[model samples]
Target chain A: MRAGKGLKWVTLLRRVADTQDTDAFAALFEHFAPRVKAFLIKSGADHAMAEECAQDVMVTVWRKAGQFDASRASVATWIFTIARNRRIDMLRRDRRPEPEDLNWGPEEEPDQLDILSLQQESDQLVAAIAELPEKQRVMIERAYFGELSHSEIADETGLPLGTIKSRIRLALERLRHSLS
Target chain B: MITHHLSDKLLMAYSTGTLPEAFNLAVATHIAMCDECRARLASFDAVGGAVLEEVSEPSVTMRADALSATLARVKAQPPVQRKVAVPPKDDVIPAPLRDYLGADGEIRWRSLGGGAKQMVLETSEHATARLLFIPAGTAVPDHTHGGLELTLVLQGAFADEHDRFGRGDVEIADEETHHQPVAEMGEDCICLAVTDAPLKFRGLIPRLAQPFLGI
Candidate 1:
């Protein structure tokens, strides 16, 4: 089932990339827009802003589809990257002090070895996350979804700052081991 | 060939897009140089995707015309040509920093005495970023940070009490940390540094000049 879903996503992205196919884009949007909205809202965006950001993410996906390399990243990973970047752009736009740090340098083509293991590595990542202890998982969630700094998480959770850092470091180490 | 790297927490913040812009510049610059961290970041991105998948669909749906509206907007704008900056010929500067440095790549350096010169990059208020050129064997004044300070080695190597940081290595320091960093003798050291607050210089001269240096 995972393979089937993954194949469909790759196909839809390719269609959008190769021919500017709106139907394919619509399918992509249907699958991703709500999820992106939820992700943004979880990161502290207002409801309306989350919705708008989600829409903007989809628009960017359509425009940059041609640049997508299926072998390097899964469709969901690619879309999530676009959503994350767009949300950051929106946040930066709202508070107008910072000069945009848009350049992340050249995107490297995925090494052939990495491409071969991409699917298995993703599966391992999901399984590894599921297996994390509840407390560790909570720390990861706060960092990822709440977008809280470690000190902020410490403040919100009443845990010592050192504890938060150690737990997250250990959890990530586990995830890395499992994925490798 | 990076001997030092961003800590896991910083990488996590960077992956989640929560880091302040100045820190983001440092992280991005390091990632541009270090493939190991870049691969690790991709793994974190995969985790992000998994979380997005696991969450129950948002109760609030997008507008029905959202897809069409997006299509219209796409048609209105020309396809984006992502300008991938060609890396400079010499390894002096990384690609991620080229936009800020511009084509000329010249910096107006202010001497920090003892052969160390610095050029501050204007960024957001959250942090101050600067390019520091330390001639071989010169040491920065002993100082502690008011808040957070992240330094990424761009060109050569430097060693503090903590450890030796080479190209692509990042040294994160905070209020509790105090050390003087000195460039290695063989070559000059160039570092891209981001600090959320001013450094607390130990020496009277540096302390007096701190205001003038604007560091």
Candidate 2:
């Protein structure tokens, strides 16, 4: 997250980055350190690795606080991005089993069509995706949100894995057209 | 056209950082090549920013020396590098999606147990776009989407309660749609998907392992 003049924390960070204010630095570190650690842990990192990476992320935050852009990215998004990059690097180190490989089942029932529908710019997208029909949404969500593989989605959805894959591909095309 | 599908709602969740790790990885891959999805995600990020601003701020208790310690370290380091910042990508999607989804994309494939292979495709400068590809015959236990479901199939086939779909087919199911699919025949199927929310897992073990599963 970039520090801006108006944002409460951004202002504080800008001051601390400019002047070596131990108190400000500590406050920033203390607030975000654990969250960063937990974020990493949630992304499949071990506790120790998460802690170490969290420290690294915070260190980067310290150095880059002056460059924080409140308009471009939220503090959480910036921190998350840092953590994400770190996790990606860790994942590249070696292959390990990923336990969270299941597929997301289906979209939660839309409470209201108005709320569920996307706005004008996004409306095109929403309409297009909505146009995909129920069957495709089922397969798509199971594979994409549920993180289920075609085979996995098939196993749970009672559909052939190949069928699930084809549906996803077609759904994407329709989305593209709607946006265009 | 790659014909890989990504939903607007899922794009929003992903941009908001609400998606589970597994699905997030897939969306990441599809977004890399699909600019339409990328633009839609940018809008989600904007909405997320507005929403986050409304979220109650977390408690801000902190040690007095935290800032000082952080400052001291930065002061001791070499001059930091600062690159000229560029404006973020647009919110308007491009036309003819294939060009975007077909661009040169690189992803790191990770194998989860039992013949299940996963890869996260990097989509944009923001890393907001992604595509997840899973081969046929892979089995993912029954589960649910975080909020929205979007799927597109490029090759092969899979079946469900409604019917079976081959290449160029699409589906958008909801909480009401719950069923498992096993790949048909010997051919593997490739799908493209995008989602926003994290999956609401079923069963105690899945719920317990949700955190570790990163889905």
Candidate 3:
């Protein structure tokens, strides 16, 4: 699965959110900061700017720690959102309107079983992406990482969807021509 | 309860942070109302998380002191969220749209004739977004779309030749579609409408007024 860290990142995030623990924060930063930097750079940030933005994102992770809900989102998913918003802000792109919140802040803890299942779903998703053909995998990376502009993104409603794809099915069909 | 959810294309674009601001507003506003779409959005977001978590070797690295700097930054800033389940407000405008409308959240309506009015929200150059008001028993002038148009009903209901859209329903129209939407009889209807291109009107009066109406 992941590296030598036996503890879940959610556990680490809980420590950060509840007690402001440095060791936990360091563990998270060590794991996530590099990836955030790499993601920003792929999204068209310069080396220096990506570094600064990654730092800012980590700080936000610290600040918004209490908002993380394992029942709903994995730590990587949450951090990806934070990094995406930071990219938009730093690039001075158009304001990204967030969907209305169904609920605000963290509430009661989700069932541990629910948390485990969601993380498993996320991990399965990662494996699924890894198993995709190289061309398909790159297409996904390009779309999420800012290589495709909004207009350049495909919207062909007529293309067929295979049963194997998930919610991203149509988006994949739309991204088909971009690679060519 | 949202029957007409956003297309997977729109939701995935939103999840990837690639949609125009206007479209983003439409999607977010719809999601605020539809938990199904929100759950769908979360799945799309997992794809992003998957991409981020994919173990590609980094060509770039964060400076060694990155964690220290982040910790320092957090010292001055308290954890900024207190998500205490703020009950959805009674106002017609949802939270994301409220920010763009009047600071008091009052919609300043401009007349579009036939008991329909509109308030265009300021978005980027990529697209146009507006709130549309149609009194009960009124019909918008017949029209077709040049590009994509997304309409999400917020209050009351409306029916066109295609289908009936109620609160939290999103009806998407593209170039080939043509319909005249009439508000359902029981209540005045309010909707959030976003378009990538201007609408084409068929009626002589509306055609003449199109230059001034900005529809």
The lDDT for every candidate, in the order shown, is 0.70, 0.46, 0.79
Q: Give chain A TM for each model in order.
A: 0.65, 0.48, 0.79
Stretches > 4 Å off in candidate 3: A1-7, A102-107, A150-180, B81-83
lDDT of 1 by residue, A94-171 (tens): 211221222212343333333334544455555566677788666766666745763454323221223223333343
Worst 10 residues of 2 chain B by lDDT: B87-96
TM-score of each candidate structure, all chains considered together: 0.81, 0.37, 0.89
lDDT of 2 by residue, A1-180 (tens): 322212445445656556745567666676567666555554566776766676677778777665554323345445555554566566542111121111111221112221112222222333344455578644443332223322233323221223222323343344334333
lDDT of 3: 0.79
Full-model lDDT, candidate 2: 0.46
In the range B104-204, model 1's lDDT, one tens digit per residue, is 87777888877888888877777788899999888888898999899999887999887999888889898999899999999999999988888889998
Worst 10 residues of 1 chain B by lDDT: B81-90
Higher-DockQ candidate of 2 and 3 = 3
Best by lDDT: 3
Q: Of 2 and 3, which scores higher on lDDT?
A: 3
Rank by DockQ, highest first. 3, 1, 2
Query: Model 1, stretches more than 4 Å misplaced?
Result: A1-4, A93-116, A130-135, A150-180, B76-90
